[model samples]
Target: MKSPQDWPEPIVRVQSLSDSGISTIPNKYVKPPIERPSLSNSFNNDINIPTIDFLGLFTSDGNNYANKSIIYEQISEACRNWGFFQVVNHGVPPELMDEAREVWREFFHHPMDVKQTYANTPKTYEGYGSRLGVEKGAILDWSDYYFLHYLPCSLKVHNKWPAFPLSLRKVIEEYSKQVVKFCGRLMKILSSNLGLKEDVLQNAFGGDRDIGACLRVNFYPKCPQPDLTLGLSPHSDPGGMTILLPDQHVAGLQVRRDGHWITVKPASHAFIVNIGDQIQVLSNAIYKSVEHRVIVNSAEERVSLAFFYNPKSDLLIEPVKELVTKQNPPLYPPRTFDEYRLYMRTKGPQGKSQLGESDKSQDEK
Candidate 1:
């Protein structure tokens, strides 16, 4: 395997090709027939990932106990059954969400040179990035993205963030502040649901201030041959959890459910949440991170923000002590977020391939 710093081929922005008015995507972007999006014969139109209302769910003290309890049960069920859900009245101003998204769209429209000024290297993958993984000749995704770190203060460098679109940096800062707060609260709720101390998950994630957080702004350019390629390939997220601010105008995210793929319809002003691998390890398989992907379109382009709430890269994440037992011992070996994520860093995504080895113990029995 090549070093992660060495990208096997020259980097090309998908937006440039989309804007060039090319009728055919390059061969590198095309997946084999079996992995193509249109090849899936089962697309469920009537179903969607669950939607939960966050309004008044955590307002007053215990006065709303019954209602809050009902919501806890709903979230618990959502995590176990689908590993994904949409939240409305999530407290982030809808106006802020709109502005945050628009600024990134504006940034992407800037001249290629301006955007390229901050092009990223595989080492940190912290700026304008067109692809994931470093494998030579790997089939590429039909998208480009801007990635930046937000937590642990040291990695939060304002200079590295976009300077154009004047409002871009500020909106990104404010947007991240709100979403990070929301993720912290959700962590507590999840811990309580697992019958562990409310702070268990947070502590495991390196406490309140030291946890790792980052944003990946995805731009899925319009594809002429949308059927032959995908905006993103099928894979489970590698972090703790992901909060997505989707383009409400289009439906592209597909969730794998019991042998069928369900296209998710974005609820206006709501955020989509999905479980990630680290959480599955911490939850001792009480919840499994489901495989999902994004699809591009022939008519319009797309932009979405994926906010990843992850654990401290160096700390070991494993099945919590309470969840392990003689009959139900740890299903996954303890692995630090850094070590567990090396597979994707070099080889890209391959449908739970990173965790498949760790999952072997469970499969054996």
Candidate 2:
């Protein structure tokens, strides 16, 4: 159990694994100080996460209504059952997605000092770093990531934005706009499926035009002993929804269902969308926010971009009145987005939903 303060700066960046020129795993990276389940035989060949198509939502032909209805049903079922789904025919331009990945790959490959120019501190949580949790003795993930606060553009820290690749900033800005738009559309569809007004979620998020959003760009380099460590621990997301663009060549993302872990296959030119804890609370437990994690591989490096959509910091989140009834009371009390963020930081990633903790506190009172 080493405290974060005592955990010395990582001696080797995972990205350097490719250039180490060593044919074998190093002693330092061989075993994690904390013990975790061995993943050597965890793969299940028969189970896979569902992939949904969004092309029906944007159709202009006379079949638009019929197609939308079918798509809506699929989304509703996926959210209620798995809390995760991959979407194809999503509107994001494929070229833009490729460019975003290229820019980030270049940025991560920069010299150590160059990448450290925008290093993150324990408190700020925005910039390039591998440290994610604040708890002492917490098992660290085997990856490096850069976090950027993209929404409420006025609140962005301009200096923390990387400038090395030069094209990084411009490409990211464009990608953010597209992602935000797609999120709004997806929220509307979810709201309709839940039998609420189409704009219910958008309005709750302070209208479709204004909302808080953030992006986490992750780079998981090849590991010498992949079975002994994890790329990211199992945990549910804390925001409203997350749009993940995963590496096409590597497969690592997995979700827990019925006490079994199922691999999520990445779809070409599509984004994986999953409901977050807030959305489950908002839906009064009708939908779920399931536990999911990433596995590391010995052969290939993986890159993923996750865009988290959230309400304004001060917005109150709770079960919608329409979804609550005498027969079904709100499962969790109202909490502001800022309060939830603080709670998650203090608690760290423990493979549990914070909303469940809120329910327990309320029950005790």
Candidate 3:
């Protein structure tokens, strides 16, 4: 699909409104009545996503094997049942996580002109952005974000990353390195969980060197009418999986479960992990990409770092040969990651068709 030269309309930074002290949000940011975050019991639920400890699961020397079997099943269960989980005792240092998140927070709080230098376009979406999709007049989310690539080496341009925070580039470089390493470990776990060789999933993702990994740092500004609009629209991630370092001070991410929306409680010094559509495709639906959205808080602004690990853009991804059987066959047609995401970027990821009619996002009202 060919992309437009630029955004369909002029971009408006959501953080500006929060700073301007507006009592009410712009009409363009309002969601349909059915899509708004409601406080009634019918909409919110008491359920919480699973939290798994990685304390003994993975070590530099080698797997404990004893602890490996236990935590392995926990991750498998979480992927099958909830498509989401929180992981603690992960190898990434706590100090680094805090530093990585704080640097982005400081960048968002900077003056508009400073952040605008890297303003992004619909073509690549590689720098600062305020909205998703180029759909003109689309109702927008109450957030601003910075998107940058990390994998494929060709695309990891240090100059493109924010520089004023001084330490921002260094932190992101180290942060991406650690997170990608963990993702590789998780891929092995997923393969083992599916009774396949440890490298099956990794190989399917174009091997480690050719993988697609990127980061989108979302800054959700406090909104006056939080209930009337969402910080992000409802959708499953289009990539393989997401490793999110959430804002511990404020809770806003919500996962849909049994037709109810459940807010996630951040685990201290932990990373939230969730399955995405690519894995679901590769798993042949043994796991799923859970539909999730972020709600804005009127009392507090929030920032999250979402690291997406995906297959190489041009590699055709399909259900693994092992997962396919005469009983099930291939549920989804083979499609490249490039072909899959083009639909999302143009049609928007708000429960729209991803790869075809077979891969439509859940449209639960």
Candidate 4:
């Protein structure tokens, strides 16, 4: 019953929330489960989402390395068991993260004409403004974002980058370099956990093929109505890995865990790493790409930078043959990134399912 002008800047409330700002999540929007999610017998408490701390990397004591392994085990468990986890203390420098945030803000603040010059062209899927889901979707979510696909550097036009702020490009370039390095490190860790050589995952990602990476800057304005809209709809990442650097003070990011929506508490100088679908296939189902969404706050504008590391569009994604056996058969067939991306667009914004080549390919020897 609240009008857009009455409630808040970003959140548009069609239905009102209870006094405590809690309300029933409409079933129409809940993510469909692979199988029905079971409910608990107890109706007395709220669910708790697990948080993975990334700070253990710095401890000089034996516990640092010990905790590091423990965290890795927990992360592997979360990936195979829960599909996602939050990470802090990741080696990416906090100052770099800070500067990356500044660059995104500066880019988006450019005059509309300048920003639009890099606007998504007919076939290109990079650059400023409300992306794919915003303009044509059936639902209206309260968020604005810019996407930059960084790999295959020739694919990127450094000139397309904004010239304001004088140092914006330099900052973004540095941040991009750091993120790519972080991605390599994560692949090594994940590969080790999967009982494979440390370089297994990295080789799968960029082996004889280019890697695909993109940076997205999302802005969720203060909404007048907080109950009726979503900042980002519930969905899983369609790439290899995602590294998110959220705003320090504002908390609106949440992931679906167990059977409920768990709010992700933002930490200063930390990055949240998530495994995406392609990694799931590469790991032979040892890892998972979980579903997540963002909530909009009515109080202040929320900003987040999500750097997506993807496999090159042409690389064929399949389970490493070594991972499959009679006991551990392959769950998916070989498919190219182009095939998967086309599947994603056809399914529209909220579509699930990692579409591979075809069912016929699943029968290959």
Estimate the overall C-alpha local distance difference test score of candidate 4.
0.66
Instruction: State the lDDT of candidate 2 residue by residue for 278-339, as single tens digits.
Output: 88888987888887778888778888999999988788898999999999998889987776
Q: Can you write out model 4's per-residue Cα lDDT over 151-246, one digit (the tens) per residue? A: 877677777666766897788888988888877877777888888998877777775247888787887766555565567765677888998888
Candidate 3 lDDT over residue span 1-365, tens digit each: 78677999988999999999999999999998888887422354456788999997766546587777789999999999889999999999999999999999999988899899999998888999998888999999999999999998999998899996999999999999999999999999999999999999999999989999999999999899998999988788888999999999999998877667789989898899999889999999898888888998889999999999999999999999999999989889998888777777876766525744322234332
What would you estimate as the lDDT of candidate 1?
0.89
What local lDDT does model 4 show for residue 97?
Answer: 89
Clashing pairs in 2: none
Q: What lDDT score is found at residue 176 in candidate 3? A: 97
TM-score of model 4 vs. true structure: 0.79
- What is the Cα-based lDDT of residue 140 in candidate 3? 90
Best-fitting candidate, scored by TM-score:
1
Q: Between 1 and 4, whose TM-score is larger?
A: 1
For candidate 1, write residues 301-330 as lDDT tens digits. 999999999999889999999989999889
> Quick one: ranking by TM-score, best first?
1, 3, 2, 4
Give all candidates' CA lDDT scores.
0.89, 0.78, 0.88, 0.66
